[model samples]
Target: MRQTSIKRLYLMEVGSMPEYQIPVVCYLVQTRDGKNILIDTGLPETIPQEEADFENGQDVIQQLSRIGLTPDNIDTVISTHYDIDHAGRHGAFTRAKYVVQQVHHEDALSGNPRYAALRAEWDQPMERIQLVQGDMELFPGLQLLETSGHVPGHQSVLLELPETGKVLLTVDAVPFAEGFTRDAPLNDHNPDPEQARKSTLKLLDLVEHGQVNLVIFGHERAQWDGLKKLPEFYG
Candidate 1:
C-alpha cells in the first residue's frame, strides 16, 4: 500500500460575507512529494463589496505569494463547485489542471443564467479540465466526496494527513458545523433539498465510520474564526 504523506494544510480566508457572517475560505494542501493542491478560489479581486467583502493581499495569487508561491507553483486546482465565491480566481491558474465533477460541470454549462456570471473562469480549455464521475482518490492522502445538493454536482474533500489524521471538508454540502447532524434542516441554498440531505447523511456516516479527526464547514463564521489560517497550517 502507498503511504499517505501530506505535509501541510493551510486554510486561507480569501474573503467574507458580513451580512451572513460567513467566511469565504480556500485550502492549500502541500504534499510530502512537493505538490501544491489548491481547493477552491475565493472571490475575484475586482468583485464589489456588495457581492462579497475582500481586502488587499487576500486574493488567490496574493495568498499564494504569502507562502512563497505563485500560480505557476500550483500543480492542481480543485473546484468544489463553480459558485461565484468559490471559483472567481480559477482562470488565473492556467498552468494548473482543473478537477471537477462531470454532473456539476454539465449543469453549470447547461444555459443556466445563475452560473453565467463566472462561466469564463471555469469554462477553460477542455484539455485542462479533468471531469470526475464519482468519488475517487485524487492523491495518496486526498479523497473527493460527491456531496451534491448545495449545487448540481457539488463535492467535498476527505484529506488524510500523517499527524492530523483524517480531515473532512464538507464544502457547502453542510456549510455549518451546527447543521452537520442528520436532522439538521436544509437551507435555501440547496436546490435539491432531498439530495442535499442524503449527501450530508453520507458525510455524517463517513465521520462516524472513517475516523475523521477534523471537519471544516464551507462558510461557517464561528468555525472559520477558530481555525488556523494561512502561514499557520494543520498537518
Candidate 2:
C-alpha cells in the first residue's frame, strides 16, 4: 500500500458544549505505513463562561485508548483554525508536531480576541509547530485545503481513500450538512461571512464535480449519528 492506501479514520469525541451538547471531536488518520496524524482537538479543560464542558466520559486519553492509541503514537496534529473548540486541545498530543497555517500561528500567538479565553491552550513549544502557507500536501494522497474566513487561516483536509474514494473533512469550512448544501455559515463564528460562503462553495464544487465521496462536517451532531465511529473505521 502506498502512503495513502486507504487510511483508517477514527473519530474521537473529546467533549461537548452545554445546552445543545455540540460535540467537540478530533480525528485520527492512520496512513498505510501506520503514520498517525491527528486533526483538530477538543477543549483541554473547560470554559464555564463559554458554556463549554467535558462529559466525564469524554476524556481524550480514554478516547484514544478505545482504538489502542496513545498521545505518543500521534506523529502530527493538524489544526483547522485557531478556534478554541477546534484547536484548544493542542496540549494533549504532547509528542506530535503540530501542523497549522502560518497566519493562524501568528494570530494565535498574538492572543486574538476570538481565542482570548482559550489562549493558554496554545502553549505548545515553538519547535512542535510546523507552519505552512496556502494549500499543502501533507502526504501522497492527503491534502490540506486552506478555506479561510471562518478565521483568517482556517483549513480543511482531503484524502483519497482506497474504498471510499475521496473523503473530505470539512472541519469549520462547512459546519454542517445544511451549511454545505445551502452555503450558509453560522453567523456567530464566521469572522468574515462573505469569505466563509465562498470557501464553502469551493467544497461543494468538489462534490458537484464528483470529486468527493464522503464529507464529514465539523460539529454536526445530526450527521455524526449516521457515520461510523472509532473501532468502526472507513478506509
Candidate 3:
C-alpha cells in the first residue's frame, strides 16, 4: 500500500452564539491515487430559522467551491457520527458513496431522536451507503478504526503518511485538544460516556506508542502545529 497526505478545509465556523467560537471544519483527504475523499459536510444552507440563532454566517459549500472543488468531485464520504451539525449537509455529496458503521445505522433507524435527525441526511441516499461492521481498509493506505463511545458507531480514520508517519482523523471521540490531553468526559451529546472514555484511552495509547503523530478533531481549530493545506501533500 502507498502512503498519502491529509488536507483540511475550513468549510464553516458555527457556534458563535451566547459567547463562543466553535468551528465546523470539513476535512478533505487526498489519496495517492488522486481521489478526493470528504470526511464530513457542514450544516445545510436551509437550516431552520429557529435553529439559526446558533449558526455562524458562513456558507460551507460555497467556501469549498471557492477552492475549486465542488460536491461532485467528492468520491467517498465518511461520517463519524449522526450529529446534525456534522452530517447535516450530506446531500451535497450525492455522487459519493456514503460510509457509516453498521451499529450506527441500526441505532439511527430505531427512531432515537439524535439519530432520527440524521435520517434525512442518509435515509434517501441508502443506495449509495456502504455500512461497515468494524475496522477495514478503505483504500491503499487509509484504514477506518472503530472508536465508539461518542456515538454508537463513532469511528476515526487512520492514514499512513510515508514521511509524517501515522495520522488519526479523530471525529467527536475527542472534540478538542484538551479532551485528548485531559481525557475528560465530554458533554451529554455522547450517549455512552464510559465508552467515550475507553475510546479516548485507546487514542492515547496510539499516541503514546508513537503510532500516530497527529490527531485531528471534527470540530476543533487547527489540524496540527504544522501541516500542509488540503491541496498540498507532504512526503
CA lDDT of every candidate = 0.88, 0.78, 0.70
Instruction: Indicate which candidate wins on lDDT.
Output: 1
Give residue 145's error in model 2 in angstroms.
0.7
**Which residue pairs in model 1 clash with each other?**
none
Worst 10-residue lDDT window, candidate 1: 48-57
For TM-score, candidate 1 versus 2, the one ahead is 1
Q: Give one digit per residue, the lDDT tens place, for model 1 in 54-171.
A: 4423777898899899999999999999888899899999899999999999998888776677888999999999999889999988999999888888999999887888999999
* RMSD (Å) of each candidate, 1 decimal: 1.8, 2.4, 3.3
Distance from true location, Cα of 59 in model 1, Å: 1.4
TM-score of each: 0.95, 0.90, 0.83
Which regions in candidate 2 have their CA more than 4 angstroms from the true location? Answer: 1-6, 53-57, 182-189
Model 1 scores a C-alpha lDDT of 0.88
Model 2 gets an lDDT of: 0.78
Query: Sort by TM-score, best first: what order?
Result: 1, 2, 3
Alpha carbon lDDT at 200, candidate 3? 86
Error of 1 at 166 (Å): 0.3
